[model samples]
Target: MVNDIAIIAIVGGLTGVTTVLFGFGGGFVVVPFVYQLFLRQPVVANHALHIAVATSAAVMIFNAGWATYNPQRRRNLSANILFPLTLFIGLGAVMGSLLAGQLSEAVIRLLFIFYMLVTIIDCLVSRHFLKGSEARPLSALTTTVGGTAIGTVAALLGVGGSVMTVPLLRKHGFSMKDCISHANPLSLPVALCATITYTINGWGKIPVSGFLGYISLTTLAILIVTGGVGISISQRYLPKIADGWHARLYVLLLIAVLVAMFI
Candidate 1:
């Protein structure tokens, strides 16, 4: 039991460190770690991944909220663009969370592989094309479509869908920095809604040590504490880092995670 607690602590520390460095990492790092840690207990292994993803989403509500709030206070962001899209995104997230429980682990793993591959390709091919574009007029149809797609991807992969949103916004003419800034705020609602959905859907299904719905409270606590501290520190240093270097790091991390998934 002590050994298990120690392992969980170490994993939690790593998750927090990565979360601070990147806006998201619990699903990428912690989910796999949890799976491996409980590999001998296969009955619980599948649910561990869901717990990690759901907990990570729950943790993001705090991390992303902090990241977005401080900046928004300093400079006015176009809330009008964010508000309408967020409404649909939240609704879709709930739907996606409900769907996750019905899918097989093999299907989820395959979907994760596809997601990682697409993200890697997107990072490589679109480096020069990532200029921030302007917000398009949000039509009801576009909001529903984009939100639903983002929510589905978020639920499956544990990413905030910023990878998709940032590019789409850039393509529409928003600047890269602006797109990132906007994406941060948008993630809050999506993550919050998704967390709630996963919780409700996963509630009797997950058998983690201290799970609530799909979320593991112990894991969420570790992530929140560590992630919060890490993000605070990283925010101070990230600006000094070169954009190209950051992008390269992002790609490398994704590749590493993808390889880990297969192993």
Candidate 2:
């Protein structure tokens, strides 16, 4: 247990770095780690994905909140681009969480993998993301429609929604920095909605200790502190990264997490 906690603490720090540098809000880092860890415990093996997703959602709430305060990140946010989109994402998150609670762990994991693969392919194929200039005003249809989709998938997979939002923003000519920064703000809705939904939906579903519905409270406590530490440390150097490299690394990190899920 001691070693496991230490390992989780380390992962928490990494989550913070990713949250600050990539606006992942700890979802990408925490999900695979928690999922695999829980799978190793005989008592929780069957419930691993549920716990993993729920706990990731719980962790993301704070991670996103902490990341949002970064001065550099805050400057990139656009009220017009964020408003109605955020409202719709929250609605979609509710739908996604309910659906997730009913699915088999294997099915959910596969869906997460598929989502990652599609995002990776789209980013690689889209030339606009890499050479983005001034961000244009977003269209109403894209905001309402796209936001809902991002929230649904993100909540279902227990991710921070940055994977979808960052790419969407980048495609619209937002800089990698702007996309990542805005991703933190956008993820807050997904994280908040998913947490409440997962807790209520998962309650009593798994008769396990140290759990609240699907969430692992112990892990959440550890991650809160360690994730905060990570966000603080990573913020110092976020400005040093170039836009192209930042975008490339974001995709690479997703590929790595996708591979990690298999392992």
Candidate 3:
């Protein structure tokens, strides 16, 4: 029991920083660690991946909320700019979560790997094309479409949409900080919608020790508190980072995550 608390708190704290800086909710990092934990319990092994994804989504909700609040307050980002994408991202998250519950684990794993590869390449390609282009606001239709795609992929992969959304936004000419700012709010709806779907879909299917429909309520509570503290600390350091470095780091991290996932 004590060990579980320690693990959740540590992961939650790391995720808080990543969620604020990259809007990833650290799922790429969290899922693997949680999967190993679930593996230790034979009874839950059958459904471990699902629980890991769901739990990650649940944890992201609180962290994403903190991530969004502080930045919007400091940056004074317009809610009007974020609303359309947010709405569509939420809708897509619901649909995505439903689809995820229906798919086999093997398929999901393959899809996750494919997405990482595609995202890395996409980020690299965009660096070339977007280098000198003038920054422009994404249109409402574009935002909605992008949000839907992001939410669906995020739910399937158990990540906050920022992993995908931020690069796309950067490609479209937004600053990394601005992209992270917008991506943070987008995560709220994605996490809420996906977490709900996981809870409902896994109601009786998940048999893990702390299961509350794939969300371990105990872990959720720990993450909320520790993750919030982490977010607060990271926000102060955000401005010191450059956009180019962030993009590069994201690609490296994704490659490392993919290797870890396979191993």
Using Cα atoms with residue i matched to residue i, what is each candidate's TM-score against the true structure?
Answer: 0.80, 0.96, 0.90
Clashing pairs in 2: none
Native-referenced Cα lDDT, model 2 = 0.87
lDDT of 3 by residue, 1-263 (tens): 68977987888888877777677765776787777777677888877788788888988787777776773544746576677877888888888998998987678778877888888788777753235245777787777788888888898778878787777677777776677777777777888887889898889886545677888777678878888888888876656666677667767777887886777
Which of candidates 2 and 3 reaches a greater lDDT?
2
Worst 10 residues of 2 by lDDT: 232-241
Per-residue lDDT tens digits for candidate 1, residues 1-263, read 56765666665555545544444435566666655655546767766566666776777687667667666422746776676777776676667777777777677778888988987887678744432234466567767888778767776556665656655555556544555566666667667776877877786885545778877787677667766666666666646444445446656777888898789
Provide the overall lDDT of each model, using Cα atoms, as 2-decimal numbers.
0.65, 0.87, 0.77
Best by lDDT: 2
> Could you give the candidate ranking by TM-score, starting with the highest?
2, 3, 1
Error of 2 at 3 (Å): 2.3
Q: If the candidates were sorted by their lDDT against the true structure, best first, what order would they fall in? A: 2, 3, 1
The weakest ten consecutive residues by lDDT in model 3 span 126-135
Task: Evaluate model 1: give its lDDT.
Answer: 0.65
Query: Is 1 or 2 the stronger prediction by lDDT?
Result: 2
